[model samples]
Every structure is written in structure tokens, then in C-alpha cells.
Target: MKARNRTIQLVILAVIALIGLFTIVSNLSAGPAKYPQVGDKAPDFALAGLDGATHKLSELKGKTVILNFWGTYCEPCKREMPALQRQYDKWKAQGVEYVGSNIGENAITVRGFLDQYKLTLPVWLDQDQAVRKQYGVSEYPTTFFIAPDGRIAKKQVGEMNDAFIESALAELVKK
Candidate 1:
């Protein structure tokens, strides 16, 4: 009886080990997942604004769209807001849409941040971070310069300056 019990336990352990091995092997075979890259079609997303209005990325097709993914906690992002606002003011009338995609933040928090910064740029609230994930934004202040044709012209990760933003806009317009 003792021998039989030991055998049963060994069999169960072997089965569990085999299952774990199989799972690992299957996952390894699946390969790395793909993220958005430059030259890819900008993924479309619809998110609400702080004012309770829904904005869709597709609606801005045929316009140069600057999608800045930012969070309230990121200092670099905070530092770049004024430059973005300046560029937005300068180019908004020229069919350029600069949108701040506030990642994983509530309307109240976003509202407070905007008020503190005195920023008037249009901001979309990405409450669930779905838009961020879609855009492959792994860092704070990842800016995507999408061309008028909806292709990603450039993916600027981290904070951006006025010159960089202006040059990117120029490139988008040239293409």
C-alpha cells in the first residue's frame, strides 16, 4: 500500500511538470507581440474629454495630428506642456490638431492639471489606458506625429521642445 501511494504521488508530480513545460513551450513558440511602429497607420481610438465630450482619432483624418500621451505625475510631461500649447496655438488654424491624451487619469485630475498649467490645448481623457496601449506608449510624454494621411510620421518618446515639435510638424507637412 505504501509503494502504491508513492507511485501515485510521483505520477501526479510528473503530470504537473509536463503541463508546466508544455505551457512554457507554447508561449515561447508564439513569439513577441507587435507594437505600433513609425510608418504604420495610426491606430484609431475614441475617448472622452474632461468636458464630457467624445473625440475620435478618425474624425481628425486629413489633418496633421499630434497625439501627446502624458500623465499628471510625469515631471517631464509637465515641463513640455507650455511648448506644446504654444505650438498648438500657432498651428491650430493651419489644419494641425494637437491633442493631449491624458493617460489613466480622471476628469477631475486632468481638469486640475490643465488649470494649474493654464493650458488651453484640447485634451482627451484615456481613463482605461486603452488608447495608450494601442499607441504603444511605454514612456511618459510619448508624442506621435501623425501625418495628414493618417500614417505615423514620427514617434517621439519622452519630453519634446518647441524646435523638435516644429520640425516634426514640418516633416509631416512635407510628406
Candidate 2:
């Protein structure tokens, strides 16, 4: 009788372990899905920039906007800043707005990074990852091309060179 009870206890423990593993696996894989697809309306979000200024997505309406999500620790995110800055400078007068969402960093750290890179584009600090979740961004250096009508014209992931950036901007600028 004791042996049978011990066997039952072991079986219950194994079942519990399996259930825990399944829950963990499912949670790790689950996340907010991507939404900045082409032709979709650019999702609106509000956050504090590195300069202590609040920016709302809806405020930049009637202009072409490039919404980029990046982080301080991401190598590719750092790599694309220079090109993005250059693009911002070139077409800024042509009605292009460049907004950056910094994930996983505080305002001071992000401001230092912006200063270090001489990036003049406005960067919003997403310290709590709320904006990132709202945008459904899963990776660093994800960019959305928002048109003058507030539609997402394009969505780019990973590091992109000046040519690709310029091409996307050119398409959005015509509006």
C-alpha cells in the first residue's frame, strides 16, 4: 500500500512539472503581434522624448513621418542612427518627420546616446515598454513609413542603408 501511494505521488509531481513547462513555453512565445503593416493606419501613441518633451502620434498628422523603434543595447539600432540622422536632415524641410522610440532605456541614458551620436531627430523614451507593446514591435530598428493621410506606407525591420531609407521617404513625401 505504501509503494502504491509513493507511485501516485510521483505521477502527480510529473504532471505538475509538465503543466508548468507548457505554461512557460506558451508565455515565452506569446506577445503582442505586429500592426505597422503597409496600408494600415499608423497606430497612435504618446510618450516623453529624450528632451523632456511629450510627443503624440496624432499630432504629426498631415505629414510624412518615420516612426523608428530602437534601444541603447542593440548594435543594429546604434548602427542606423547616423543614416537616419542624415536622412532627417536632408528631407526634413521637404515635410518629413522622424520620430524614434527608444526601448529599455531611461531618458538620461538615451539623451547621452543621442548627444554622443549627434542625432538631432526627436527620440521618445519608452522606459516601461508600453509604446513598444502598443506598436507590437518585437525587434530593434523597426521603422514604419506613415503617410500624410496617416496610413502606414511601409514597414522595415533591421538595419537599412541610406538608399532604402531615401526611397521609402520619397514615396511618402509626394503626399
**Model 2 TM-score, all chains together:** 0.78
User: What TM-score would each prediction reach against the true structure?
Assistant: 0.80, 0.78
Q: Which residues of candidate 1, in runs, are more than 4 Å off?
A: 1-31
* Candidate 2, RMSD to the unseen true structure: 10.0
Per-residue alpha-carbon lDDT of candidate 1 for residues 122-163, written as tens digits (9 for 90 to 100)? 889898998888777889989988999999889988889999
lDDT of each: 0.89, 0.88
Tell me the lDDT of model 2 at 85: 92
* Per-model C-alpha RMSD: 8.6, 10.0
Q: Report clashes for each candidate as comma-separated counts.
A: 0, 0
Instruction: Provide the lDDT at 45 for model 1.
Output: 87
Clashing pairs in 2: none
Residue-by-residue lDDT tens digits, candidate 2, 85-158: 99999999998999888887877888788888877878888878888888788988899889999998888989
Instruction: Find the candidate with the highest TM-score and give its number.
Output: 1
